[model samples]
Target: MILHKDFASVVGVRRIGKTSLVRVSFNDLKDNIIPLSINLGRLNGKNYSVEDFSRLFLEGVTDLIKNYTFVVKLPE
Candidate 1:
């Protein structure tokens, strides 16, 4: 579904392994796709704002870019 540009949502009660399932899937597809995993539950009790979410999202992207390698080919 992801390869076809379709999005997937895993809905279930807490502690039912939803996160684990997504993590495993992401690991399996790591070579083919870049995965950004963020846990919003950490902000469940704090006074968080949009900036917090944006920071987390950007941090994830930055980490991925720093850890992964991409190559571009040029025509000669």
Candidate 2:
């Protein structure tokens, strides 16, 4: 289903299973969609600004997608 073209945003409280529903739905479109889940809650107490949040989220998504491409894993 087209999102903005067909429907508006679905609003709900945090941790209310919104992501679960989205994941389940997105599964059906896996052939065309590369879903990325970022837990922005990681910034809960960090007091990150809007720009900070955007940067962090992008970095997290990039890492999630590219981690598998590395020839060797780094030590934790």
Best by TM-score: 1
The C-alpha TM-scores of every prediction are: 0.56, 0.49
Report the number of the highest-lDDT candidate. 1
- Check candidate 2 and list the clashing pairs: none
The per-prediction CA RMSD against the true structure, in angstroms, equals 5.4, 7.3
Q: Model 2: per-residue lDDT, tens digit, 1-76?
A: 6454333244477879977787788777745555556666667666779987887779878976785355767899
lDDT of each: 0.77, 0.69
How much does candidate 1 score in TM-score? 0.56
Native-referenced Cα lDDT, model 2: 0.69
Model 1: lDDT of residue 4 = 58
The parts of candidate 1 lying over 4 Å away from their true place are 1-5, 11-14, 29-31, 45-47, 70-76
lDDT of 1 by residue, 1-76 (tens): 5565656778677799989999888888846776666766666557889888888878878888877877689899
Worst 10 residues of 1 by lDDT: 36-45
Candidate 1 residue pairs in clash (backbone atoms < 3 Å): none
